[model samples]
Target: MGRRLRRAGRRAPAVAANADGRLEVFALAPGGSALHHRWQEAPGGAWAAAWQPFGTAAGGAPRVVRDGSGRLTVAAPAPSGVAVFHRRQTVPSGGWGEWQHLFGWSDAAPALAPSADGRLEAFALSPGGARLVHRWYADPAGTWAAAREFGEPGAPLAATPTAAADATGRIHVFAVTADGRIRTRVQERPSGGSGPWNAFGERLVAPLPAGTPAC
Candidate 1:
């Protein structure tokens, strides 16, 4: 029942949704120029991106999460580093209020997820390659709290961390291991922190058929 986050950005475009039922898209421009992103109220809502150039050329991956009230939280890669973005306004027909930069730099791609009631909780690797960090905000600019870590760093983590939350707002995180094993971690709210990255499952990996990364 932990939160969920996905990888989005120029290198790997990602799409996320909140409990409020909105979707956000993340992508990159040509030649690593900028990180492009967008969000929609419904299926056909217009999408927008920060698209500013700056930070790690290689991305940590991007993801999005939504709260119960209809707010969306996005964890995306930027030139300066990995950060969090939140959706605050409602578009009359097919628009969204501007995305607000909520949380600052993260050591890795963020894991975002929404609670059953629309509250949002976000997670990411710490500034150093040590602890997994979690944070929650009532809205775009609400009080921010320091969340507990769910896992400890054992080996260098590769790939973007993916997260998911259940009906009760419990969170689960999975890491695609260097050796291709699926390592998983979990946590609970208010107290229970991250667990160890234990081998739990396997992903369906297939040989690439020679396709370029999506833009």
Candidate 2:
């Protein structure tokens, strides 16, 4: 069974269900300057009222995903473009860690997906949305590896990047190329490392005007 959940004021919500079946939704707060969250206590319970997750203002859409162990991690564009801030819920019972910074310059919101080995991988558009950048940690609590850009530098981005992990643990990133075609990059490793990016070369939609692209 399912129903449309409602919050009086939220935008670009990112949802993830915990191992115990509770649904957690993170969104840009009403003011559009902070992160707000709501969650289900059980399968059919009423959604909680929006509340700030970490008292931090968010500059872009928030992304949330659950790792293999059911821990929840969230990433959003910081009000400052110099970094992205993330918070992790270490336990299902609700002990969330303090917000941590991942330094990288992103002009668009970020995406998060759990790797096959239970770690988390993050993707975002570079400054001016002209490049795709990604990074991941060895584990939820481990050190983060270096950030790497995909595709050729200066390649124009037609939209914000989205990512997903298949059953086999391969991570795939999808985005609109400057020519209005869809493109993808695959991460060969299950632990969040990416392989070469591959483009579909087929125009999926009309190209947007440069500098005003949609994700």
Candidate 3:
């Protein structure tokens, strides 16, 4: 039978498995006051006794992804919504570092996906929701590339984006347009660069609320 894992806030939790294969969950506290975390005591085993505070003053649900080196990193928007912050495990399946400012002026929480080359890439909606912007780690040293606009110039996104890496290592991003249509873009070559935005070819009966998962 299923058992209660832990009490969580209204925002949906984000989960990822560590290099050692243990599953970890990140959730926002009620009212997005803080980001909380818990994990299996052992790979696929019992849960941690208590939820630990990962970070405070989270603006939205947390997004987690593993770097090429297998270390897990998490990102979340600041409570004021003007910027995003991130923290990374000092080593794979080890302790985490303090939160540090990652980027700014996001309308919602950012989406994270590992690139084919092992770098972690982040995507966020511009303040007006008219464009998507992204940046990537340049190396394991943690150098970040300058943020750049993504998607077509005239096509405005209506909601936050979500991303995932395919088996072949290409990263695909999906977003909802104002008219309830889904659109997507992908990397031309894994971590090489991006391809043109394309219609996903399905219109929803109604617009998906902001932050809805696209894929």
Candidate 4:
């Protein structure tokens, strides 16, 4: 069986592998007051002795993604749900910079995915969960583009969305709809326009339990 770590968290932890291959974990503190982090001392090795208080994260679990340059960036929503904050490693597998506003108006946790060309893209549900919106870097390690709605304007999501890049480098986003159906949208081209959202797997027999993270 896997051994338990020392600290507790308000939400399930988010994890990612560093450029050096060490495993890092980020978690939200009880009451969603802050974010804490721990990491493997070495690749596939024992975890750090204590959780380090990283930064503020009003609520919801944090999300981490490695940009094309190999730097890790983490983002979380603010308490009011009107903004998101993020921090990035100064260098690949190195120390992180101060937390900075990332832009938002998110009603739920945010999701991130790295583009084929090395740019980073962020996704979140609009204030009422009535639309999915996203923004992406203009270029690898560059400024961000304006946020825009994703998918058809009338469609709504029941929970936070999740995103990942496929082997071919196209990014795909997945979410659960109000009716308990899974839907997905894919990049029509690497680091380019997105295709329309489409139904994914067969409808779930029962809606996922509240707080369950949908793919």
Candidate 5:
């Protein structure tokens, strides 16, 4: 069953759930200048708050994730590069902290996920889209590690990259290759180092549709 739909702008929305179970949604405004966020106060509760605007002059769609403590961090394409922004609030509807820009650079959108250990990691395509680069917030708000590039010298990715962390503490990143197949790389927990880049060797999925944004 589906509820009757309401219309919005073209940019896709990103969502996250807090530890307390509040639902938060973020989307790019029609003009692409800022992000609009809305959230619920409780389970099955009526969505409260209007779409509040922040981060003027943003680019692409925003990516959001929650830390172990349920704080929110967002990354979106920006003029200089991708900018990571953070917003922290208490439960039962609380005031949000000031937005802070972290760091990143990519011609395409960035991806973010919390590792099994609860550290925040961000993945983005290089400025030229020739390489995949990443950085992590060891403390999720403290100093960030130096950027690292992964994958072999030649085979380039053809679309925006994505990442996920499983219960076993393994973080997997996936992308579509120029040859129209999918490739994956893993970074095991604790040590936080990646294994070899493995092309699935089979065409697991078709290439991204045309006009899809580059990863």
Candidate 6:
């Protein structure tokens, strides 16, 4: 599992998507290496992040998320690869339940995202390192959609991808390019006939300073 695994001095930032297809940034604990956060469309219909305790996987990557009705869903990833957690509807006891191994482990270290419509989508880089993929299943019992590529053929050489969802349910992904450049890409439903997936493109996510000192 390739977790965010930030380099010694580099802090891996949390990422999430917005309806405008924009990726938003969050503050990190000083000297902290990894970040885990959830993307939810707030009451006014804006993207907001719910950050999990730094370095704590107790309730899994995201301790909470927004359900379709905007109710908070607290779920956790289990060792058995199931998604399980306690919510207001959990049954008897203190709002907890048996662990459910939703999606088995991906060596790439999986990240969970709640889409605009409230469906949970998980993205992981191929264990063997070939493609960046996204898989979605409605609820715990929902069938998983086939894996979708999040980026072009090139691998994220230096930086890892942090995922996010927008108010419209579109997905935005951010990653550090091979040359240390920040790059972002998004997936969009075809605006017209379904000839092919011609609705995607890549652009500089965070452009580097335009001027530089001569070596």
Tens digits of per-residue lDDT for model 6 on 1-215? 12333332233343433333334333234333333443344423654445444332332233333334333333333323232322221431112233344434333234455565556565554333344556665454334566666645654423235556666556666555445455565556311111222222354444221111000
At residue 30, give the lDDT of candidate 3.
70
Candidate 5 achieves a global lDDT of 0.66
User: After TM-score superposition, what is the CA distance of residue 11 in candidate 4 from its true location, in Å?
Assistant: 0.8
RMSD of every candidate to native, in Å, equals 8.3, 4.2, 2.9, 3.2, 4.1, 10.6
Each model's total of backbone clashes: 32, 0, 0, 0, 2, 15
lDDT of each candidate versus the true structure: 0.49, 0.67, 0.80, 0.78, 0.66, 0.40
lDDT tens per residue, model 2, 1-215: 01122332434477888777888877665544556677886776877654545546767667777877778887777776656777888685486888887647774457777788777777766665676667777655746778776655546876666788887778878777677677777877766456665767755777554323144
Residue runs of model 3 more than 4 Å from their true location after superposition: 1-9, 209-215
Which runs of model 4 end up more than 4 angstroms from their true locations?
1-10, 205-215
Cα TM-score of candidate 6: 0.44
Better of 2 and 4 by lDDT: 4
Q: Tell me each candidate's TM-score.
A: 0.58, 0.82, 0.90, 0.88, 0.82, 0.44
**Residue 175 CA displacement from its true place in model 5, Å:** 1.2
- Which candidate do you rate higher for TM-score, 1 or 6? 1
In terms of TM-score, which candidate is stronger, 4 or 5? 4
What does the lDDT come to for candidate 2?
0.67
Whole-model alpha-carbon lDDT for candidate 3: 0.80
Q: What is the lDDT of residue 195 in candidate 1?
A: 54
lDDT of 4 at 103: 69
How many clashing pairs does model 4 include?
A: 0
